[model samples]
Target: MKLQLLSDLHLETEAFEPEPAPGADLLVLAGDIDATWQGLERFAGWPVPVLFVPGNHEFDGRAVEHVVPALRGLCTRLGIRLLHRESWLFDAADGQRVRFLGAVRWSDFDVFGARERERSMRAAGYFMRLMASTQHGQPFDADAVRREGLACRAWLEAALAEPAAGRWQQTVVVTHFAPSLKSADPRFGRQPGTASFCNADDDLIPHTDVWLHGHLHCRHDYLVARAGRKPTRVLSQARGLVDKGEAEGLDPGKLIEL
Candidate 1:
């Protein structure tokens, strides 16, 4: 299937909007299309089917408990599929079957190392809380993200472990926070703040056909896998912050064949 991916557009800025790639079978919005979640309305009558997974930005300025239900209502009304700890199956006209699993996959702050975890939690947590979101009527802090991220990781792992008794040809995992450090921009690889954007799930890379992520404001395409396993693609096409030059490499019209 030919698929197009777009994320981190941050349309709340109102400075940019993406042009859809012609002939694309589906469009995957990885996350952060807008902090207000209003930009999604623009795609209400999108030419092709759309799949979305919420990013951290989606919860900004709102109670975490309230965002999902509101998103569900909006997505339902707009005909967009909102994926949150869920899997969706798509059958290509030629009979190929692909399963997509999506979630926020907030970082556990374990991107560095075990020794630095405590420090990562303290640092990454501060960075995340800067979004000023609340959960269950309280600040949604790092510990909250870690709990959620760990659960999401486990859910994806379990889903991938399912037997292919049914006949799906491939699995695609999508999340706002990246699953592996290899997905992070090299220049900021070891930074504590960067740890908030990825997790230590590199081992999971080889288990899926393709992994797409957002949260970083740059574009990337790379291969990752287990020690002796076949490589899988880990890609990101995030149109990140405009002022910091992080959005420099995005190709608004790029598409990938799955």
Candidate 2:
């Protein structure tokens, strides 16, 4: 199936403009659809099926409960599925079976030997507290880092397990953040202390065919090998097909065949 991917669209009604490629079978909004409902309304008129996910900005510094339903309803009206730590299996128009796993995943680098265990632990603790604070209606806390990371791992385990029955399964993992430092922005300029793409390790499962992410605006194309077998394609459409120095808007007008 052909898919057009876009992400990190921090739209404020007036500034949001997406002119996606024409005639795409599917459009995937990787995350951060927008900080307010304005962005959702802007995309309401899109012609094809859309799959959207929540990003850090989508939360608008609020709890998930507060914003999810609104976005979900908007997506429902537009025939889009808002995936968050969720999975879906369906057949394409040509009868090709496709499975999608979406998560605002946490970086798992330390466990994967991609980063220092101490650093991973520190980030984990911070993520856990963040999640907790959001749940309790309290201000942001660094401790939620671990909670978010562990939750993402748990969600992915379940999401990836379902397609094991098929010999020729196509799995796409969509997230707001990249899984490793290999694809991180070069602005850090080789600093050891700089966090990787997702600030953690990424474990690409055997069935994964593509990994789509955003958050690092300056990054564009990347590839990674998982398990020394099938090649996994990693793509970010922060500015679509526009080159790094271009003055184009965030919504790049490219259509990707998935």
Candidate 3:
């Protein structure tokens, strides 16, 4: 199957010209497409199947509990699938069946180690503070964000271990947060307190054939070698815009064959 990958459109501020590949089987929007729910309509008339995963910006100035359900409802009405701790199967053109497992995958502050976590909480005032002020009339504290991350991790682990996971000819894992440190920008990963919220633990790296993620505004496509399993390809296609409304000129969009 040929799948086109795009992310971090931020359409509220930047303009996007969708260049869909001819005969593309699917289009995956990694995250941060827009801040408000109305921005989803930009993708309305596409011909191929659409899959989406929400990013932190989706909940900006809105309650997470409310925005999530509203987005899901809108997705259902539009025939788009919004994945969160969920799985779906697609029949490929080559007569092979492919499975997709996905989640928003929040940051647990564990990627930077214990000492960094302590310093980040002290210096950066905990990662949740980044979103606390954005939430509408609701208390989005550190504890709540931490608990949500824990739940996401638990769900992903359990979902990967299901017997059905081994039935697919190929498996792809999609997330809105960076799952491997290698996929993150070197400059951001070296920062003091900002790195923790930019990545996830590498525990799920071995189970997927292709790891599709978008959080760090950089694109990565490389084989991650593992112990006993085949190398997994990590792809992040984020067309990040600068202050003057121009692309960062990095990896913008990618077409992957599975």
How do the residues 2-34 of candidate 1 rate in per-residue lDDT, one tens digit apiece? Answer: 889999989998478677788788889999999
**Which is the winner by TM-score between candidate 2 and candidate 3?**
3
Candidate 2: deviation at residue 215, Å?
Answer: 0.9
Which portions of model 3 show Cα errors greater than 4 Å?
A: 122-138, 244-246, 250-253
Cα lDDT of candidate 1 equals 0.85
In the range 134-191, model 3's lDDT, one tens digit per residue, is 3455576554555567788898888777766456788888888888677767655656
Index of the highest-lDDT prediction: 1
lDDT of each: 0.85, 0.65, 0.75
**TM-score of every model versus the real structure:** 0.95, 0.79, 0.89
Please give the ranking of all candidate structures by lDDT, highest first, separated by commas. 1, 3, 2
RMSD of 1: 1.6
In candidate 1, the residue pairs with backbone N, CA or C atoms under 3 Å apart (3 or more residues apart, or in different chains) clash, namely none
Global lDDT of model 3? 0.75
In Å, residue 90's CA in model 3 sits off its true spot by 1.4
